[model samples]
Structures are given as structure tokens and as C-alpha cells.
Target: MSLFKLDNVIQNYAWGSKDSINQLFGIVNPNHEPQAEIWMGAHPNGCSKLGTTGEPLSEVIDQNKLDVLGGYTAARFGGLPFLFKVLAAETPLSIQVHPNKRKSELGFERENAEGTPLNASNRNYKDPNHKPELVYALTFYKAMNGFRPIEHIVALFEEANITTLNIELNVLKAIGDSDALKAFFSAIMSLEGERKEAALAELYAAHARPAKTVMGREALQYSKEFKQHYNDDIGLFAPLMLNTVELAPGEAMFLHAETPHAYVQGTGLEIMANSDNVLRAGLTPKYIDVPELIDNTIFEPIKPEDIRLNPVLKEGKMSYPIPVDDFGFDILSATDESKAQYLRSAEILFCVEGVATISSEGQSITLKPGESVFVSNNSSVYQYQGNGVLARAYN
Candidate 1:
């Protein structure tokens, strides 16, 4: 195959945005259901299809793995190793972590041996691959990523005057270790019944007062929003403990396995290792596997600069660097001076803005906004023209 049009899958999750995806794709939903994600890969859970024919992309890849995917990619990953998505989050997602490869394999095997149903809400691991993700902000995006510095969290809590949290905060301050952070986080998640309700009430009252610091103010703002959506949910306090990340358009962040994260609000392009094994801690009506989450979560503090991926401009493409062999991503902007680009592996190109014409060998496809095309590895050389922004995922 040279280049084939892909019919993507749109996931309608509760926390999704109403207007973003619909507006991007130019679809008007009469029922006004949330459009959470538009998936553009061969992942079994929500696989994309060949345009008009309704043939599954996964089936096509399986039948011609070596030709569709390069020989090296096919040998290493068996099929497509990456899943691409356009994610729109209006409300906060669950506080969650994904397991490393070894842990994921172990957990998947254990659950399978225990006869856990694949569709069971309690199931933790869906596949044995570790999910390391990169998010490119399409709009102003807000998220909670990794643990904040222990000292900062303690000071925030002390200033907030939450007497209930003091004990756990004190333990964290005293130990000053990763284990202490785990213990403190665990204590917060374990709060129950009247105690949990009281803690939430205290948290709400604390945010009611004017915050002294910028981070404190941010925490208060996020907490207020969280409370509005999920009243009495203990996970609402997560903003106080996790680093709040705000991404401008064109900025990107990479999330490795075992990193605790939640997308607070935003629309973005996300690409990750093809896995759906999420171990959730709290902040959802879904299953909260506290023990599993704690085991997989890394307690190390992550600075804002650490997760940010600075793009390198070369030719007309801006490449986002990620330290993974499973996938490569770049933003291709075609102007009048743009030139032909060569593909080393199978690639998926999505036009986010403007209009672009992509040509491979003798065949060409014109992609408008929200349109995507899958270029097979057999098509080695491709050229682009017309003014537009294209997000490309390869290998």
C-alpha cells in the first residue's frame, strides 16, 4: 500500500470536552455527547479502519506486518507499537500511573491466571507493554504531573491550616524519603467515611482564603474546580501535592511509566506505546486500585523543565525529542518553501490546521483539517505542499 485514508475512532468519555473535538472535525452532535478522544492507530481496543471499506487496520497490519511496518519495527514490536490520539479533556481525569514493562507483564499474567475478565472494571493491566506518552498541546492545556517537592507540599498544607493533614505532612517532613512520600500519599488516599468528608470540607475552606504564593493560588483554583465537579472526592486535593503543569500551544510534555498524572483540562495530541493498562488512584467513579497504584507510582519530584520537550526546527518540520524507540513524532508545517521528506517507517499524518497535499510515489492525498492518511512503509519518499500544520507519527 502507498497511502490509504483512515477512518478514526472517536471515544466518548464522560470527562471529554463538548466543543473541541466536534469543532476540530466539523461535526455537530445533536445529542451533545462528550468527544474525549479520536484514535488513529491499530490498537485492538479502539482500532482505526480503512476508509469506506470498514476493514480493521489491525487486521491489515497483521496480514502484511513486514510491508506495512518496516522489517525492524515488525521484528521488535510485532505490529504498530504506538497509538496516536487527539485528546480533549473538559473535566479532570483520574489520578493514575502506568506500570513499567516488567511490572505490567507480571500484573497481566497474574490477572489472566486469576480468571479476571478482560472487560472487568477491576482489571489493571490490559497489555504487557509500558505506556510512555508524549502530549503536544493543541490549545492551552492544564495538567497535574508527578509529585511536587515534599517541602513545598508540607508548607502548602501548613499554610492551609488543615489539622487533619498535619499528621501525614509531619511524617513526610520527618522522614524526608521516598517511602515517606508514599506513606503520606497513601494516608491521603485511605481517608474514608466521615473523616474523608471532613478533610474535604477543611480543604474547601482553606481554598476559600486568599493564597499567598502563586503555586498555592493555582492549587486553590484547581481545587475549587475539582470540588465543583466531584464534591467530597478525596482526589480533589491532588493539586496541592502534584506539580501543576500549564502548556502553551505547540509545547509538549513526555510522561514516562510510573509517573503520576492527570489531565486537568485541555485539548492535545497524544502518542503513546500501544497499551491501556492504567492503575488509578482516585478522582473517578471507576475502580481505584490503591495498592497497585502505589506500587507502580514513583515518588520522585519532577520539575517543570524536566518533562518539557523542546522542539528542534529543521527544514519545515519541528521534531519533538523523546527517549523511546517505539515511536517518533514531529510537527510538519508546509509553506511555499517546503520540500519532500523521506519516511523510514510506517507513518500516520493528521492535518490539524489549514490544508496540505501529501504525495508518495505517484499517488497523492489532500488532507483538510481533521483528515488523516496512513502511509505504508513501502512508500519511502513523500512530498508535501500547501500551507498547513500536520502532526506525523512514525514507527
Candidate 2:
């Protein structure tokens, strides 16, 4: 089949919203479960099934890699290189960072040699691939991305009179900016016993008063919200340390390897390399290997302009250009009949809003909000008719 309607899996993580998916897409949820993510890919964790044949997408792709993934992608990546998802975060996600390709490969191999089971809760790397993802906001999405500049970070702590980090802050002031940032972060993560608790308490008390500055207000607000959920986790200090971002509808952010980030709230579409390797720091009860996380992470400040991935209009579609070859993203909107180019690689087309029909190879498939179809590389050129907003993912 050139086009297969996809039956995806919705992951019910504890941080998910109870009604976001249902209210946004009209998906049935009689159980009122928290729907965290709708996975549309061939990952072993949650492989999509073909609606017509009930065959697993991964097995089907293995049957005909070249036809399904196209020649270059097949040879380069050996299979589908990307995973797509609709991620909804009602509460804060873990403050985490992904390993780079080299680190992930080494970690995966080392863990295998150590006889650590793949399903082990203490496992740090799940696959040998790096996960660099883009989050396209469907609603007002809030998140923390990367570290703030050294001066800004110092200013906030100083203004709040947070003496808990007196020694670390002094080191930051003593050393150069770049080296100091990493050392300070490592120190913060390694904080133990009364030191950790005292710091959290001091920070909490500091935020009790209304912020006196703009940045201060943002930090205090996020810190308070996070403390509500994770009072014990030191990650509540993330807002004061990392860059806080709130993307308006239609805006997007790209998170690369070695960046410390977390999805605070709201809904978005996420596309990434087919990898599950995540090394967490805080804001979670999960096992955290602080040294491993610090070793793999790149401690650098990301400018505000660099956080959001600006769209480049190309051939009637708004393309989100990424640095990696594992995936590509584009937003296409049509209110009338629109002709599109032939498939260059395997793709998943998701209708974000309105109704539309995809026609190719003498066949047609109608898609509504929250519906999607997998277009194999063998499919002929396709066209869309009717009103809709579609997100197309390809390599």
C-alpha cells in the first residue's frame, strides 16, 4: 500500500493533561486518562500499526526498507530515522539533556557490556542514536531551555539574596564565565543532605515576595509553579538559572543534544530522531546520574533568538530547517485545491485543523483533526483538497 492510515498509541504519562487531547482532537476518552503523547512511528516502545492490515509499521518497513524509506535514507540510517508525536504536558517534565551521538553510542555499548538490561530503570541510554527534537507549539507552550547568561544568573541570585549558593556563586564570580557555569551547575546537582534542603527552602522563601524586576517575576512565577509539584526537587531553581520561554501558537523551538530543557506546560507537536536516550537531572523521581548527565551535556547559554526555529517559506509551505538529517518538518495550509510535489522520502502527514483529503496513486484518504496517514516513498505525487492545516514530517 502506498498510503497507510496510521493507528497510533497515546502514552498516558502522569504529567499529561486529562482532556487536552480529547478537547483538541475530539478523541474519545471515557476513562478520562491523562494523555501525554500520541506516538506515530516505528519505535519499539510504541510502534504504530497500519489501520488497514493491522501490521506493525516497523515490521513492514523492515520488509521493504528502500521502498518505504527511500534509497538515500535507507542506506544512511538503515531504517526510518525519525519519530513523531503530539506531546501535551499539563505539569513540568523532568529537567534533562540528551547525549550526543558519540556519547550515546559509547554509553549504549558500555551498558550492554555491563549486562544491564535494556528495560532497567537505571538505564541512561536506550538507543545508540542522538535525540534532537523540535517542538511546534499548538497552544501557548511554556518551557525552560538552556542556561541563562552568567551575569543574568548572578544578578537574580544576588537580588534574591540566596546565600545558600554562596560558595558556588563565589566560584562563578572567581572563574571565567564558561567554566564557572559548568562547575556551578555540577555543584548544584551534587548538593546533598541539609545543604540541598536548605537551598531549596531559602529559594522558596525568597520567591514568597513579589518579584521586583521583569526577569525576576518570570523566574519567581515558574519557580513557584514548579515547587507546587516538586517541592523537594532542586529543579525548581531552573527558572532562575535557565532561559524561560513561552511560545505563542504557531511558534516552535528546537532542542539539540547536550541542552538542559523541560516542557513546563501546554501542547505541542514533537519530531525527533528515533531514539529514547534521556539523561535526567531533576524535577523527577527517576534515578539521576548527575555525573553522567554533566559529562554528556554542553554547558552554554542559548540566546533568545536562537531558541525558536523560524520558518523559511518554501514552495507554499513553511519549512522548519533543522541541522540534523534524521528529520525535516514543514507546515502546509490549504483552503482550496493545492498541488504538492511527489514524496522524496517516507512521511507522516497529520491534519492539525479542518478537513482535507490526500489523493495519490488513484486512491484517496480523508483526514480530520488528529488524524494522520503514512505516505511511503513509493507513493506518487499527492494533492490536497479542502480546508486544513497539516504538519508534514520527512527525512
Each model's lDDT comes to 0.88, 0.89
> Residue-wise lDDT of candidate 2 within 1-395, one digit each (tens)?
68888999999999999999988999987898899999999988899999998999999899999998899999999988999999999999999899999999999999999999999999998889999999999999999999888778888887677898998998887774778999998988898999988888788787888778898888889988998888878788788789999999899989989999999999999999988899998899888998899898887888866898889997668999799999999998856866675788999999999988888888789899999999989885788777988899998
Q: What are the root-mean-square deviations of the candidates from the true structure over C-alphas?
A: 1.4, 1.1
TM-score of 1: 0.96
Task: Look at candidate 1 and give me any clashing residue pairs.
Answer: none
lDDT of 1: 0.88
lDDT (Cα, 0-100) at 381 in candidate 1: 79
After superposition, which runs of candidate 2 have C-alpha atoms over 4 Å from their true positions?
Answer: 174-176
- By lDDT, the best candidate is 2
Per-prediction tally of clashes: 0, 0
Those runs of model 1 whose alpha carbons end farther than 4 Å from true positions after fitting are none
